[model samples]
Target: MSAVNDTSFNSAVFLLTGIPGKEDVHLWISIPFFLIYVISIVGNSVIILIIKTDPSLHVPMYIFLSMLAVTDIGLSMSTMPSTLGIFLFNYKEISLDACFAQLFFVHLFSFSESSVLLLMSFDRFIAICNPLRYASILTLPRIAKMGLVCALRSVALVFPLPFLLKRFPYCHTNVLSHSYCLYQEVMKQACSDITVNSIYGFAVKLLAVGLDSLLIFLSYVMILTTVLSVTSSTESIKALNTCVSHVCAILFYYLPDIGLSVIHRFGNSSSNLPQVVMGYIYLLIPPLMNPVVYSMKNKHLRSRLFKAFCK
Candidate 1:
């Protein structure tokens, strides 16, 4: 593949990279990736279906969960085609527009997922700390409005990314680091001055995901404090029990994400294999595991899922 120098953004193409040194076994590798995509799709879809069809789950917590399922599905869809294409078909060439579009949706859903998790944290906080007001505070219309705000925030922040990258000329190798596009990976490929792109990208991640994480942390802190203040041990246990699934969700999503970011920023350049593995773990595991976590933790959801499967 030739280097892209002084090329128009519309005409430029990027070669997506599969696992380093594992190109010969890409077909074999695709089996697990394909299964991941299928399970993520089916799992999140089932979660959404159960939430939507079950009148009993029409509360704030489950509403946020349904939103999360949708975001997971969106994230899976955003990465699936290019990822599976590279591994299964050796179709690694991606057009500039398509790459940018994929990056946008991937980050969009990712940020929105963080936001939904924060919202869920708040849901738990209110439900546990101030149970009497929970119904008044998190009504359906209010939840809908909150979801809209999260969607708009994600779009508003992510929409400018493609345009910002497009303004820069890529005179270096256009081969990307991952099978699917990422903002940082794509920005590194540009030959021109990327100071603005780098600053803006960092700022966006800090503002969106970083802030959401901080708030989620604070929400949990308050939750724990509230639980401790309860006079009855049974009440405390019940309150904490309600948060088990959400806590699992948070850990599954953020731990891998934080590890991936650390690997990207500080990892050795010679270790492409670890970086690629972390990327897959960061992107695929949360979506694949969230439904399972929720199903196992929530008795109602577990029963519904079992009935659905048995049927």
Candidate 2:
């Protein structure tokens, strides 16, 4: 890999776009964007608040749900500043330091969310497949440790990204597809050889998001196996019902990412609108829908939220 000591490369500025080729309609688009920001912030906030205040929700499932809510809040907030600037105020310039900082937090929360989802799936597996040992297996201390590990794992893995990029020179075009910075998106503009960055980035993705997804799927398979072995249909339905919200949460988190990947892989690169929409869905939909999904599926949370709002 080549390194450049040019001051201009180090001080390069990146330009972020809202929706390429759709700038004319951005004014109207800002309406939904603004609403999404508001809903995600308020919705996840309510979930966190509810989980904290309700003594009955002091269980492993609820604790994981609270962790998911916190991650959603961080993920949403990471993109909102630049996204709102692009859509509402037409602010497109982002310094290298600021861009890298945003990139760090964005990936940090994304990986953390993936980690929490995996843990939540494991929680379901234990609660369903090993009911008697559920409480014994996942005590409060263990749960806290799991949460800490998730946070630390994400931070440690993504911490090297910005510094890695900084070592390279960005002398090429600085335009990015989305308003926020991403690892692959930023590294593509570097003049130096990015072989190391690409390899390391893929390794991290494979180990964190890809590996976590595989394990979560295996957890559900085990859960299904246990559910089927139960004798009574009523009991089987009850066992599966508890997993609906979590399954929905998983779908919400991964489907858009898959779609965006497909779009980028096959769709015409000249057409940026599709990529932009899919990217927004990846970031916005989960945070907005997660609370709604959990509250509706969980009767206790639903009732508490109802009473909380009514008062």
For candidate 2, lDDT tens digit of each residue in 119-208? Answer: 999999999999999999999999999999999999999999999998877878899889999888899899888999989988998878
Per-residue lDDT of 1-311 in model 1, one digit per residue for the tens? 23443445448799998998888999999999999999999999989998999999898888999999999999999999999999999999998889999999999999999999999999999998889999999999999999999999999999999999887766567987788999988998887788898899889989898999999999999999999999999999999999999998899888888887888888898767787888888899889999988988999889989998999
After superposition, candidate 1 runs with Cα above 4 Å error: 1-10
By lDDT, who's the top model here?
Answer: 2
| Backbone collision tally, model 1 | 0
Clashes of 2: 0
Report the Cα lDDT for residue 166, model 1: 80
CA RMSD per model (angstroms):
2.3, 2.1
lDDT (C-alpha) at residue 171 in model 1 = 57
**Residue 107, model 1, lDDT:** 95
- Model 2 residue 50 CA deviation (Å) reads 1.2
